[model samples]
Target chain A: MTYCIGLRLNHGLVFMSDTRTSAGVDNFATSKKMFTWSVPGERMITLMTAGNLATTQAVISLLEERSKTLEERDPSILREGTMFQVARLVGATLREVIDETTNEGQLKQDQFSASIIVGGQIKGGKPTVFLVYPQGNFIEITQDTPFFQIGETKYGKPILVRAYDPDMSFADAIKLLLVSFDSTVKSNLSVGLPFDFQVYEADSFAMGTTRRIDENDKIYQAISEGWGDALKDAFQHLPSYKL
Target chain B: MTYCIGLRLNHGLVFMSDTRTSAGVDNFATSKKMFTWSVPGERMITLMTAGNLATTQAVISLLEERSKTLEERDPSILREGTMFQVARLVGATLREVIDETTNEGQLKQDQFSASIIVGGQIKGGKPTVFLVYPQGNFIEITQDTPFFQIGETKYGKPILVRAYDPDMSFADAIKLLLVSFDSTVKSNLSVGLPFDFQVYEADSFAMGTTRRIDENDKIYQAISEGWGDALKDAFQHLPSYKL
Candidate 1:
């Protein structure tokens, strides 16, 4: 299980992913899920994946391999001209990799499953966010749904549904995202800390911010404590039935 | 889809459930998910159901029917001597009803498809809570896992995970339950307005307090709005990313 969120806001795009993977409860390990491909000012695409570790790793390896062999890879994401085209490229790569590995007659037979959040800007296009489904098909974020989340999403979904807005200030967006993540982490053992996050200013045409939030991070701590306190205070104010 | 939670606090027990059922996004209707079987001072039991409305309704009907039969029958929940006996009776009823309905049919069926939270106390026994699984087997709320939730539980699980404590005041417990319900209502279309809730006092052995919260309820509205604002304010107080 994983929790990754990609937000498309007026000020910028925010990408956050937890770094935890496991085959089972006792077999847990931390693995960074966020992958970024950048050609400096030309294009910067970020991918955060969730699902079967082997399948996710296979997909990432294939994409990274494509990035390295651009000449041989005709429709590579690195060479894509628009953000949409890049999504197509990523989807195609996902489909190809899932097919190659999960198809029958393979030594390690398993279900093909992986979902990715692709968010970035091409030199000539505006920054966009897309949620690629396990089937390799994708949906772009719209004004109504300005964010995309994949993996163990329910516990954290309420905050995003209630608070997210297309015109929300970047600060508010990030805070909401953190609270959302905090909710998920508290409930799920599969999603663990040392979060990977990046913020891209809408028209900056460059990566706006990137950092890893650990257990001791001040902001993360504040969000955790504040949310707990707010919930307690909120609970106190509700009308109680007089017994 | 539905969301129902049962909490076993030191002072008493709390049960809450939403009242919405849906086959899909297009087909939705309001259905009460909470039920009470009270003999006032002798015993007061509240049952909340979630999952497979047909199955839940069947179980409720059976329970209600049994309540009527207590006058004519030798053994029934109302006539039961102990809370444990009452729990056993409910479990046996659930098992019998599910097996009879699902086993005798040729229809494509979901096995033991409804989950229930049964909480109350007989006059002689201490207040108790049980989470009855679809299979008719059940688990008592313990000090370690003092609360049980069924139906669309994940959304409301986080607040409890962080804030619940054995010594938590009844006031705090009810507040927590409401906020948790609020989170669930916000996230899932399957869980909706008009919540039914009851709080039982430990030694009172009766339906101590109960309320039906609707969209127009002022206190609920305040908690919802205050929580959102407090979250934003808390977020503002946190230090921003330096980058």
Candidate 2:
């Protein structure tokens, strides 16, 4: 299992993903799920993968393998015209990998498949988030749906739905995501520490402030404990039910 | 889809459940998912159902039909000696209903199995809650596990995990539960009002406060609006992530 989220704010896009993957409860391992493909001043595309570990890694590796050509290949992500096009490229790669690896559709193959959140700024386009399905289709973020969450999303969703503001600062955006991820980590064993994160400021065309939040990051600790205490304090203030 | 929760506090028990049931997006109806049986000073039991509506309805109907005898008929719920025994009775009845309706297990039989949470005080015994599975097995709640949530539970779980206190007043317990339910209702259309709720104090051998909170209920409205504001306020007070 995995927990990943991407926020499309007025300032930029924020991405957060946990690194824990397990074949079963006993067989646990950590693998980075956040991948970045940037062309410096031109564009910076970020992706967070969830679902099948093998399929995600394979699709990402295939992209990296194709990306080394220096000149953008026929369907390379760097050569895409827009953020939507980049999502399409990633979706196609994911589909091809699953189709070649399994019989029937990947979703029906032992009921295992993968999904990705593709978000970034492409020179001429605005920063936005898109959730690409296993079937190679995608939907861009909208006002009503300002963010995209994949894998282990429900435990952390209420907070996002209530507090997300389109005009919030980049600092607030990442803090909001960390709170969401913290709730998920505490509730689910399959989602854990060393979360990879990055902020792609809109129009900057640069991947800025990338970091891995391990088990003992001081800021992460402060946010986790502070948020919990804040929730308790808030709960205390709510008017009690009329018995 | 339904969302029901039961909290086992040191002072008593609290039960809350949404009333909406939908077969498809187009077909929605309100059905009572919480039922109570009491022999006044002798005993009182509350049951909340979730899953296949038919299966749960059949199980509850069967238990009610047999309770009129005032004698422990074959496997009647009202005749159970302990809360654990009541859970076993409900589990076995649920299993019988499912087995009679399908070829395989309820879970595998068109995925129509039902689960239930049973809680109350049987005279001369301590108050407790038990969650009965579709397979006719059950487990009692304890100090480590202070609550049980069935059906669409994840969205409302983090709040419960972060703020639940066994020593809190009954007013606080139901307020906490209403906050949890409010979050679920806002995020999911499948789980909606009106909500049925009740509280049972330990050793009272009686049901305490009970109410059916509809969409226009004043307290429900206050809690719903108050919680959204409280959460946003809490989010603002959290330390921003230093990038």
- lDDT of candidate 1 over A1-243, digit per residue (tens): 999999998777989999999888989989999988887778888999988888788788777675556666643667878988878877887777777766576533245578889999988788899998766789998888888899999899877876677777666666778888888988888899989888888666667678888999987897788778765665555565333
> Candidate 2: which stretches are off by over 4 Å?
A66-75, A105-110, B66-75, B105-109
TM-scores across all candidates? 0.89, 0.95
The ten-residue window of minimal lDDT in model 1 chain B covers B103-112
lDDT of 2 by residue, B1-243 (tens): 899998999889999999999998899999999999988888999999998998998898798875557574553567888877888789889889888887753343355688899999998788889998888788889899899999999899999999999999999998899989998998888999999999998888888999998999888788888888988898898888777
Tell me each candidate's i-RMS in Å.
2.6, 1.0
Candidate 2 structure quality by residue, lDDT tens digits, A1-243: 999998888788889999999889999999999989899999999999998888888888887776457474543787889988888888888888778777863343344589999999888788888999887888999988999999899999999998999899888888889999999998899899989989978888888999898989888898999999999998888777768
Error of 1 at B208 (Å): 2.5
Q: What is the lDDT of residue A209 in candidate 1?
A: 73
lDDT of 1: 0.80
